[model samples]
Target: MKIMEYMKERFQNLEFIPSIYNQWGIGIHFCLGENIYQLKEKEELNLKRFQVVYEQITIIFNELFEQNDDIFLVTNMYKHKKEKCIRKLKVYQPFLKCKNQKCKNHLNQILVKTYPYPFEINKAEEYEMQQFSLLCKPRDLRVTELLKAASNEDFPLKPKFGGYSTDYPDVFFVNITKDNIFFIYDDRGCEVIALDFKRIRHLYEKYHDWVEEYKCM
Candidate 1:
């Protein structure tokens, strides 16, 4: 079956749910090359347009996952202007500090001395400490390493700042696990959703002709 047909079947089966809040409605944003298109509930959701957007997204994800096992899909939200609806999908790598043993040990000592009781630092403070550490040693270090040394996994490090933008509400993070795929949406109202990836994967498998076309060009 074609990808749009497959997606339509899934929609009929109620496999996916639309994102709808009291004031704000849910929509799908597409990033194709430099152009962006949106299928929003407020503007009347177009199934065909949504299918096309999702097909493009699936192709991008399949290509990316082929190169790397893990990645993030970032979508930028816009409220009033369709022209400003810019969606960006890219690879996300968590910041890691030092991989070396000696540097790791040195950074651990610094954390022990500075924040003995497990404290939190803002981005500015974190940067300052990173600079201080770099000046103090021959060993290379990273801010993430220092963060890991100071905090336990259960109580991991978190950013001090809050989400920005009233116009652009949320950012999505997609990841593939061994058994399933999942996504997390971070938003201003703390509106978050975690969903399975099967529906999307099915769409990708159904319509992958664009992949061959791109490869040829």
Candidate 2:
């Protein structure tokens, strides 16, 4: 089922959204640094703890996302927008498109899906969107630039990557810039959905408290 809502019914016509949870599927939720970010009421303390763990999670995500792997970006809207809260995306038109036919052909070359973020819930639907997926090599997406630029109040600006086994062949949905969590599920389905997670396991083995696991929603 869909974790988020579509801004328009027409978007339903595209390929399936990656966030669509798989039926009868097992998964894992890597908690944000032992949930320490929630324990701290003092903003400074939380930020300090968050920085350390965030870097660690970013490392884990990077390890999972190989440098040469084909990646899918849920695009169509602006790269960044005003987010009052997590998942609640309020946006303007992002002027990111292939400037030339070569680039356009390189992008969205195959596999496209349209999905919504949390903003479509309640009254935020006023910001009608036309979000769809795009596919390209990792370098084509400009991973470092996208990550560096989106460290602030934008949905995609602070994105994260997630691997979901949504019915067979498996899928990797990299929410380029959103939350602080680096989520992946290998509880079942294909053991080789993507990377082998050698480093993530090393982190868990040596630093169990640094990571948290939960059944995906």
Candidate 3:
């Protein structure tokens, strides 16, 4: 059976119903109803909820393993001690192809599944990237740059963080480089090519002032 089908079946069997169902129907969400229950009551309820979620996750892992033992090797479930709930579930194997094929040859990649009990469910792509970074080591300088750029939205020349230029209309070209260096060019013709990640990150933090100045100009 497919992963989604397995998950759906397992979730359906659970006694507690999911508060929200994802639009794709593949993802399930359960809220702790923090407002309705007291802290101690919530903790007790969450522990029971975690047990159910963990069982469902284990079922999924077993299904994945049955499909391809080599593809899915490690399965781990983590819970928040204070809240007494499962926060994340990770399933991974060595040298797996990324779903996006961005890192086809990279080793030790992981897939993270999070519960809505602890984390807010939004931006699925961003969460996937975050999980990928946590599980896999950087294979090369280019991979390193891409991961860093994705995580740090405030990076130089990032359009999302208000880094833009009329000179370079295509923001992607300006932010990403063939040489794995970030090139930042302001409207004043001043340029900064950062080879080191730390240096570039520091510059990213400091660039807000420059952005303010540029806006005034």
Better of 1 and 2 by TM-score: 2
Model 1 per-residue lDDT tens digits across residues 120-216: 4433232211001111211232222222221211122232112212221222222332212122121101111113333334433554432221110
Q: For model 3, how does the per-residue alpha-carbon lDDT over 1-217 read when each residue is reduced to its tens digit?
A: 3223333443333211111111122221212112232224534433333333233333322222222122211122323323332222212222233544554433423334443222355432232111112322223223322322222332233212211121111111111111111111211112222223343333334333332111100
TM-score between model 1 and native = 0.22
lDDT of each: 0.26, 0.35, 0.25
Q: How many Å off is the CA of 162 in candidate 2?
A: 20
Q: What TM-score would you give candidate 2 relative to the actual structure? A: 0.44
- Structural similarity to truth (TM-score) of each candidate: 0.22, 0.44, 0.20
Task: Give the clashing pairs for model 2.
Answer: 78-94, 150-157, 156-177, 158-177, 158-178, 159-176, 159-177, 159-178
Q: Which consecutive 10 residues in model 1 have the weakest lDDT in total?
A: 129-138
Tell me model 2's lDDT, rounded to 2 decimals.
0.35
Best by TM-score: 2
Candidate 2 lDDT over 1-217, as tens digits, reads: 1212321221232233233322212223334434444235553344554354446545555755665554454433312234322121211112223457756464434333333433435544433334444544455554543432232211222333222112111223442222111222322111111122432355445544544442322
Clashes (backbone N, CA, C under 3 Å), per candidate, total: 0, 8, 0
Candidate 3 residues lying further than 4 Å off, grouped into runs, are 1-45, 67-217
